[model samples]
Structures are given as C-alpha cells and as structure tokens.
Target: MPPRAIICPHCGKIIAGDESACSWCGTARSHPWWRLLKPTRDTARTDWVAPALLAANVVFFAVSLILNFVSHSGSILTPGNNVLLLLGASGTIPIDRYGRIWSLVSANYLHGGVLHLLFNMLALRQIGPWVVREFGASRMFVIYTVGGVFGYWVSYVAGVPLTVGASASLCGLIGALLYFGKNRGGNYGNAVYREVSGWVMSIFIFGIIVPGVNNWGHGGGLVGGIAMGMLLGYNEKRKETPVHRALALACGVITVAVLLRALYGVFPG
Candidate 1:
C-alpha cells in the first residue's frame, strides 16, 4: 500500500513525510521573516527556463562577437551591422522593406556589446528565476518571448532603424513581477511591488542618461508583461494549466521558425 501523503496547507498540494516545504507555494515548515526576502533555493532549483534563456543569449552573443571580430578589426565591443542583421536585429528597414518581422522574436537573443550582454544577463539571472517560480517555466517563456516581440514591434513602429538586446524581455519579466506584487496584496506582495517599482524608476533614469536607448521597447515590453500576467495569472492564484503549456509550445515553434529565416537570410544557399 502507498504511504499516507501529507497535504500542504499553503497550496493544498500533497507531499511526502520528509518534505519541508510546499513545492507549489514555497512555504517552509518553519516560517522566517527573511525567508520571504528571496525565493528559496528549492524553488530556484526547480526552474529551467531562466537558465536556458540565459544560455541562449550567451551563445548568440558569442556568435555575434566572433562575426563582429571578423569584420571589425578584431573588436568584440560591438558587432557589425551585417552580422546583427544576419542574426536578426529589429528595425524599420528589416521589418518593413524586407518583411523580416521574425526579428521581433530573434532580436531578443542578440546583444550589441560585451557590456550589453553582461548587464542584461545579470538582470535576467536576478529576476528570471523568480518569474519562473511564480508563473511556471512555460508561462515565463510566453511572457519573455511574447513580451519581447511586442516590445520590438513598438520600436519598429517608432522607426528605430536598428536595435538589439535582451532588455525588452528582461523588462517584461520585471513587469510581470510588478503585476505579481500589486495583485498579491500583503507584506510580501507589497515588498515585491516596492522593489520592482524602484527597478522601473532606475530603468527610466538609465534610458534618459544613455544615448540610443529604446524607451519604446522598454515601455511596450513592460505593458506586454503586465497584460500577460493578468491573462495567465500567477501560480498562487491559478495553477499551471494546459493553456499555458500550449502557449509555451507555440512560442518555441515560432522562435525556431524565425531563427531559420534569419539563417536563410545569412546563407541564401
């Protein structure tokens, strides 16, 4: 006979005798004030999307870095425009004249410079896992990919000739967090709201200070993320459903098809 399972009070999920926390809600056996400070290690370990996205960005950056060096006097500081176009940089020209709309999705994985890659990856590392834990891997991917596409499309519509980076997706994640915080409505939720609000403020300041920054993408991505979070709902309020899984699968297929188009543009043979 199977052993009797203990039901978790937090999320109402069943668990084994030795389990110390609710895998679904992340409530520990012993409540600690600082425990709510960050997601526990177990929650972090259960997620895969955040790391996979990070690695994909890194790999794409390496490709662009090498190609940039080949054409730009051995410089990895900024990839040449040709390599960026080949890898899918979003712009009015690419999207309108050539009909390279796929760049909306592919552009999320491309970065401009080493520092650009580093900063975006660092932000992803910090916030991505939290989003994955809250929304599950599939929903998180939807937010990142769809939000990014929406963000880049805004930039395209605004006539930005060329833009590339993961900032839009990262902003989406932050926007999701903002939604989570505002809706949750408690000390923990309030804390999340306050922290993410600070991030939003800082991003605005950074955009104003930095030249060539695409505020349109950032704003659109944030709005997209909020919309996704509202539509999808969080893990606490609603469990991972088939709809989320299906959306994630659709995003994956679309991303692959877009990348293939980018490759064909590069080789054409």
Candidate 2:
C-alpha cells in the first residue's frame, strides 16, 4: 500500500506522508488523530455572531430564573412578570411609563418561560446561520437588532403592555431568507422561498392559536427584515460592503448601550 501525501494546513504545501514536519514551512505536522478532530478551514472561519446571540439569550433566561427563585422559591423554571420586567421586558409600560425604551433590545434576550425560550432558541439556531451565511455576520447583526427594535416599536405603538423573546429577530431572519429566495431566482432559490414561506405560515398559525402571542411584533420584524435585506443585499447578489459593517457596528453599540442603561435602572446604587 502507498502512503497518501499529506497537505500542510498552515502553508498549504504538499508533504511526504511519513515526514514528521513540513520542511518547506518549518512547521510540525499534526497527528492523524488530531487531524481527524480538527475542523476544516471553512468551518473554523465561520462567524460567531449566531452563537453569541444564542448564548446571550440563555444567560438572560438563567438570570431571570435565578431572580425569580430568590423572590419566590416555587417560581423555578417560569419567571413572573415582575422579574421579567426587572430584567427588561418590552411593552408600553416599559417604553412609556418608565421611559425604559432600551427594553426593546433587552427584551429580545428575555423569554416568558422555558418553553418560550426553547422555541425561540431553536428557531434562531435554525434560521440565524442562514442569514449570517447569506448576508455576512455584520449584516446579520444589523438585521437582528434593527428588525427586533422595529418590531417592538410597532408593538409599543399598538399598545401591547408586555412582550418578550427572540421570535421577532428569528422572524427577521426568515424575512431575509424570503428576500434571498425571491431575488436569487432559480431552483435553489425557489426551494428557499418555499421553505421560508412555510415558516412564515407556521408562525402566523401558531400566533393565532397561542393566547399571548405578539403577532404585531412578528409582522413588523418580517417587514423590517425584508426592507433591510433589499437595502443591504446578500452575498450572492452583492459582496458585503463597508456600509453594512458600519451599520452593524452602530446597531451593536446602541444595543449594548441601551442594555447597560436598562441594567443600571434595574439595579441602581
């Protein structure tokens, strides 16, 4: 049997399979077991925004649960409205009565219950990566921040007293997918369109059946995402530009600032 030639990942040079090191690059070659465990360059290069967002949601849920348990022992997995509001639930009251408008972004990280958190996180895990791939990580963050704020803003204007969760942002991702499908135009594009359309239908149908579902936020997010997707363009249609990165930076800064303010208000000195 012949030994297969090994490729040097660092310098991208062919090396003798039996050699311990790459003489060309003066780098040590990885062991076969290590090579098997290591991720491909593409996978290693993948963006972290989606996972970061997911972690933020989980952290907020854990905090909310802890606070609730401290206040009332029986309220374990499901937190009460008081704790949720303290953690920054969005609504007319938080936006109007208290002037805590930052709740719009903060609320995106909060959830009503374990099931609510699970559902939104699952949807985000499914849809967020697609947006990151199509629009780039920076553009994905902008769409999520702007779309969620717009959705919550619409809900506040429509007089919703309270709402929380990442569904609005997930819906924004869906809208981006829809835009991609509609503009790309091909078998793959058609398939994307069909899949996203099914998601939209499922969301609306679920909203109708759920007693506390915020349909307004979901609709506004979809519209916001579509508009952002059109304006920003996707990777296939156009490359990510400086403008998209700048907008994403602005969105991130504003979101972070607002959340800090909300936290300060909650735990004043």
Candidate 3:
C-alpha cells in the first residue's frame, strides 16, 4: 500500500501523514495559520514573474525618457526629476508634498538614467533567478516588491527628498540570498554567502563614493529582505504555497494599479 502524504507547514516539503513532527524541519504538522490565509487557487508554475518585473522596469524607463523629451527637461540618457516625479518617484517629496504614498510601489520601476536602469536590471537579472530557485518565484516576487517599499519607507523616514530605482529592491534579493546561504550552512551556502557579501561590500563602497546614492534605501532594503526571508522561509524548508502565490499576485495587482494611476496623472483626459 502507498503511504499517505501531507505537506509540512514549516519547511513546505511533503511528508508521511502519520508522522507527528515534520521530518524535514521538525515542525508540528498541525499549525493554525492556514485558516488565516484563504488565498486563491495557485497551481501554475511561476516562471513569468521575473521576466514581467524586468519588462516593467524597462518599459517605465522608456516612458520616462519619452516624457522627459516631450517636456524638454532631463537629457535622453537621464530623465528629469519632474518626469520621475510624474512617473511616481517616491520619497519625502512625493509622499509629503503630493500625498502619493503609493509612489513607493511605482518608484521601483523608475530610474534616473540609462546606466541606472541597465545596472539595476542586470543586478535583478542575476539575483532574481537565484531568489526564484531558492525561495520560489512567488515568494521571490513578494520579497522584491515588499523590499522596495520598505527600503523607500526607510529613506522617507530619514528625510530623503527624492529617489527612484530598483537598487533598493535588488538589495532585498541580496539580503534574502545572504540569509539563505548562512541559514543553509553548507558548501553551496557558504559560496552564496561569500558572493552576496561581496555585493554588500561593493554597494556600501559605491554608496560612500557616489554622492547621489540612497544609502538609506540600500540599508533598509537589506534589513527588510532579511526579515522577510526569515518570516517566509525558503524552498528547502518550505515549498511555494497558495498563500505565497496569492501574495505575489496581490503585489502585482497593486503595482499595476499604482502605475496606472501615475500614468493617469501624466496623460489624464
């Protein structure tokens, strides 16, 4: 006879139903949080999530350039602050002056220059896959979106006037991978830790040398990423669940809505 199987709530691996503790992580099978999360159906594989994010960032940068050119403001390579603000660049200026707190989400897609977009996208391209592999695509998206928001929030609290870019969110991915490496604690884990640590050091140095870098956002993103990684767990400990998928979808929906609202502000009828 075949054994009955159930998923471990903590680690997210399937286990024999008869076991009292999850053999994978030793967590008790009977946890109550499932009742709190009545998420929608999520059976599909989530390969599209990273590509979609990359596309959004690139499209937003293109739009920013068009607006800057039309308005005769920032150069072709670098969009003006006005154009970025129109596209929902977040920080104290947008949040306080315009009362667009939602810009926190939109700003993740905006960038100051072509190089800014290129560097951030490259970083995302590298880290996004690693996160998807380790955390699952849904969890990866959730971490990325929330990390951007939290990082900007930190910068706002620190009184940064204006900011735009995906670096904060990229830092979040790095932080998550760092936590994964250290927590996993093996040859592969150590390798991930070392590589991510190099990123952290480079970012720190860049923030120090680059006068315009938002160090607050980078630091905040790192902190937020670590917190989310711990809270959400990972693939080895936990498989992607309906709740993770639902959260990612919710983040996507919110992002789209905010972008639309920003665009409406730009080209309102």
Candidate 4:
C-alpha cells in the first residue's frame, strides 16, 4: 500500500504514515485506536455529510411514496398514516402496538408530505454546514441522530400517536448552533446565536400556526441538541477525538441497520 499523510493532532501538521510521531509537535502519529477511525467512510469528510443525509432522506421518501401508490391510495404529496407507519413513522402507535422502538431512528428519515420533506431538507442544507464547521462532522451526526431519538421519545411520552419528519433532527442542529453561539460568546459566536435564534422563533411560531406540527419533537430535539453539544464539545472548545469518531461510526451502522429493517418490514416475503 502507498504511504498516507495524516494531520498531526497537536500541531495541525501533516505526518507521513511511515513516521512514528509528529516531528513538529512530537505527538505520536497513532493512538491506541486511531487506525480504527482512520477510514470511517465519508463521515470523516465534513463536506459530504450534509449531501449524504439529503440523499438518504430523499431515498426513504421515494420509497414511502411508492409504497403509498402501490396500495392504490394516498395523497401524492401527503402519504397515508398506514404507509408512514409501515415505513417506520414513530409514535405511540408504532411503539406501543408494534413495539418497534427502532422507529425512533428510522422516523428521522421518513416524511409525511411533500412540504414536510422539502422544508426539512432545505433547513438541513442551511444548518448542516455550520454545525459541521463548528462541531465537526462526527459530532454533527451524533447530535442529529441522538437528538432525533430523544425528540421522538419525548413525543411518544406526550401521547403523539403518529408523526414523521426531519424537523426533529434539524431542531437538533438548530439547538447545537444555538449552544455554540450562546456559549462561545464572541463576534462569530454572537452572529451564529442571532441567526439561530431567528430559526428557533420561526420554528416555534410555525409550529403554533401549523396543525399537525410536532412541537414536542422540535422542543425535545432542541433540548437534546443543546445537551449533546455540551457533552460532545464543538471544534472551538475541543478537537474531534477517537471517541467522537467511534460514536459517529456506531450511529451510522445502527441507522443503516434500522433503515434496512424498516424496508424489510414493508416487504417480508
């Protein structure tokens, strides 16, 4: 294999793969489990993370749409409750009746309507880069996945019988940005806070006016994001660690498995 180059953790200098340690900072080139995280697919690259998420959501939405159409019923824009449930919509119904706790993860990829998908994807596009820049890609995903799960779990406890959308995960991004801005406390941080605060207000206000909006999910995701941001620590506060990378890899694997299971449930032959 060809020798690879790595950025030194201590000094941000490139370390040749053959080197035992960084010449500039004298930090060891490899940690105990550094190699385990070295090749973590595209998640290591922050630029690809947002687009990958967009694609995954679109793919799931397409599947949901097709299944709804296959049944010869359901609005073109708004899928039926039955279809959403089959595709892993999370709530009291799926959790209580079906005992599909895994829906909490899968539901983040499903959508109820065209507008629901578009709005959420657009929001994700806008917020994803900022979170990645501030928190690093790994932590951004952790915030999204964990925040979404916590959001749906809260809504389930609140007696929401059925729900499907990416807004819950987007709220997690918004929450992380909010924390990054408020806690960082600088010109850049304040700017982020001001921008994210507008989003927060807009989200709650829209939720108030729009019927069927899951404000509980949004609120829960927001809180979950804040908590995750604190616990994970953004780039400004700390660099991405092997632990962060491992957590992201775990979330990615678990998510793929759950989504595949959701697909299988729709076609169990």
Q: How displaced is residue 143 in candidate 3, in Å?
A: 0.3
Expressed as tens digits, the lDDT of each residue in 1-269 for candidate 1 is 64455654334466665667667666764554345646656666778888888898898888787777776733557787778988899989778777888899999999888899999999998888888877888999999998898899888888899899999998898899899989986656777788899999999999999998999999989999999999999988988899899999999899888877776776688
lDDT of 4 by residue, 165-254 (tens): 888899998899899889876544666687789889998999899898999999999999999999999875799999999999999999
As for candidate 2, its clashing pairs are: none
| Local distance difference test scores for all models | 0.84, 0.80, 0.84, 0.85
The regions of model 3 sitting more than 4 angstroms off are 1-46
lDDT of 4 at 70: 91
Q: Is candidate 2 or candidate 4 better by TM-score?
A: 4
Local accuracy of candidate 3 as per-residue lDDT tens digits, 6-90: 7754345676857765665444556554321221123124456667899999998999989998999989789999999998999
- Index of the highest-TM-score prediction: 1
Of 2 and 3, which scores higher on TM-score?
3
lDDT assessment of candidate 1: 0.84
Off by over 4 Å in 1: 1-37
Each prediction's total of clashing residue pairs, residues at least 3 apart in sequence or on different chains, is 0, 0, 2, 0
Angstrom error at residue 237, model 1: 1.0
lDDT of 2 by residue, 64-169 (tens): 8888888893367898998888889999988788888889899898988899999888887767766776688899999998889888988888999999989888
- The predicted structure with the larger lDDT, 2 or 3, is 3
Give per-model CA RMSD: 4.9, 8.0, 8.9, 9.4
2 versus 4: better lDDT goes to: 4
